[model samples]
Target: MTSSTQAVELQSFLSQITDRDKGLTAACAAIAEIGAAAAEMAELIALGRLYGSIGAATDHKNTDGDVQKQLDLIADEKFIAALRRAPVAVVVSEELNEPLVLNEGAPIVVAIDPLDGSSNIDANVSIGTIFSILPVLPGAGEPTAHFLQPGRVQLAAGFAVYGPQTSLVLAIAGKTQIFTFDRRVGAFIRTSADVQIKEDATEYAINASNYRHWDPSVKIFIDDCVKGADGPFGRNYNMRWIASLVAEAYRILLRGGLFLYPGDHREGYADGRLRLCYEANPMALVAENAGGAATDGHRRILDILPASIHVRSPLIFGSVWLVDLVSRFYADPHFSPERAPLFAQRGLMRG
Candidate 1:
């Protein structure tokens, strides 16, 4: 064909693909659709809002609900349904016993904590949804397709925190941004620019009583940070321990901090506490994308994939510099370990 003829054909083809119809071919364009779904879910959750009334009903497993007010099944149903309508292939929710396959052939899979931080719901504290998205294999069908996908393969991950005003934060690839709902305009407006983590921080969060059962690497890092001039970190570090992942993440994002939930030896607590699919995967995405870090106290959290939906893992995620310091403490051998049973016969304090 002549050059002129080729140019004419290209123009015609480009005209055929308008902005409204080109979303699927472009990931950025597709974000609006996802944001819309998230907003709908958030709105539905805002309905019947209450203080101390969230996990009110007895769950089906014949066990006490994880929190006092997890009874808001209606809100969860709406959010799960909203996710189902998207191009998601599988959805693993905190509320479900097993993963729910959305479509057999869709390219996207999402794992969600429908309601995080419900324990503090009565206090009207910040609670929200955490989600991780990964692409599905072309022909894997529904069985075991999700568990095999590594966390590094996530396409998009985010959370919708229902605080005084709902905030939706997203990390697509490595770009982190925040969208806040404008109650007056009734739309989510992009408010925050690129989020950056401070190079160092004074605050760290962890359940420190289990220091005995913690891996030597984590124990060393914590002990060093707290030991000030006598230890490797050489700086006095403060500690905070809020059990809520969303709340902890928000606090870190607002200021600068670190949070660790490492493997412990408590009964039925072998792999630490947080659910990997929903909590670790999504928060890792946010932290890393926002110039921070996320890990299992040994390796990056987003680098590991789950073998099951409810699989739990040790999570130590926060400021990039702080995480790197923790990793260095793990790498070095000179630090004093909080526990030495697995290696050295006795602690230095032992007679």
Candidate 2:
């Protein structure tokens, strides 16, 4: 109604969404710890910059040819130590093959991608860390559904992007907020768009060689993006694919864009590249809370159940209009929709 009334209402609305959640206070304190330990990773990055020394050649990856640096492990361990002091009961990380029960007395459990986009470090590219907080299980309280819970059950989530200036984006259920690091105060200050996502976007990112391996919905979207300022979409769309989760997500959040790392035929990529709890869940939380969306090119990321903390999945996120359109493509009989390439092309799409 009135300006002052609207301001009060807005503050009230924002507070209720953020404060009403139970574990939020604990989350804030934990993030403070995270902020401090992250400095260690930052120091490592800077040190590497000076000596040009990274992980040894023996520190290769178990999955692919990507370079796994020494700093990566260092960052993970430091992060674990800081998290160990929190009210956390369990912890899961992409670095470790299994979950680590840091404290038996804690309530919430945490899953994290300790150093996302690590490969970019050697190349001096932007990188980050991602985390999902949710309730553990039985004996867990209402706001408690965050720690030990699966990605699907995630009650809270967020990511820390270490670019030129470190920044954090968080989603607490219904709303999202972005905060930037203040070097002087050594604290994160609220900044940028109030975590609201654009309804639609004029950009898209996906690795295109897997075109043939993609399901129908993915193919259709990729075609539209590449088609650019043409086709039914009308607006020109730029294409991007850095193969870095944090960089891709940060780009989308800073301005507006769509990113897809969907299931493909690549070896070890049956489910997808990104882990559900560490990557997708946090992306989903922030995306949806920002008024955008995140999905597995099928269902909402927040809705997909995780059989384990380290489960992996295909991720397609950003721009609510784009996401809703993907949902429609999957649901519609005419949108090249099907389970696999065979049916998607020869049967399901043969009108």
State the lDDT of candidate 2 residue by residue for 1-351, as single tens digits: 001222122223335554766656555546666766765566566666585565443355523345567767777888899998887777777777667777776656788888887767777777888888776687644322333344556666777777777777666656676666666665556665455655445667787878888777677767765665455454567788786787787778766778888887767787888888788888888787777888886787888777665668888888776676676666762563234454333331232
After aligning candidate 2 to the native by TM-score, how far in Å is the CA of 26 from where it should be?
2.6
Model 1, position 17: C-alpha lDDT score? 37
Kindly list the per-residue Cα lDDT of model 1 for residues 53-165, writing each as its tens digit: 45465444311235324434544576667766667667777777667776666666777776777665555567777877776766775555665666877776778787777
Q: Which sections of candidate 1 miss by over 4 Å? A: 1-52, 61-72, 228-234, 331-351
Per-candidate TM-scores read 0.78, 0.82
Candidate 2, which ten residues in sequence have the lowest lDDT sum?
Answer: 1-10
**Candidate 1 local lDDT, residue 47:** 56
Taking all chains together, the TM-score of candidate 2 against the true structure is 0.82
Q: Which candidate is the best by lDDT?
A: 2
Worst 10 residues of 1 by lDDT: 1-10
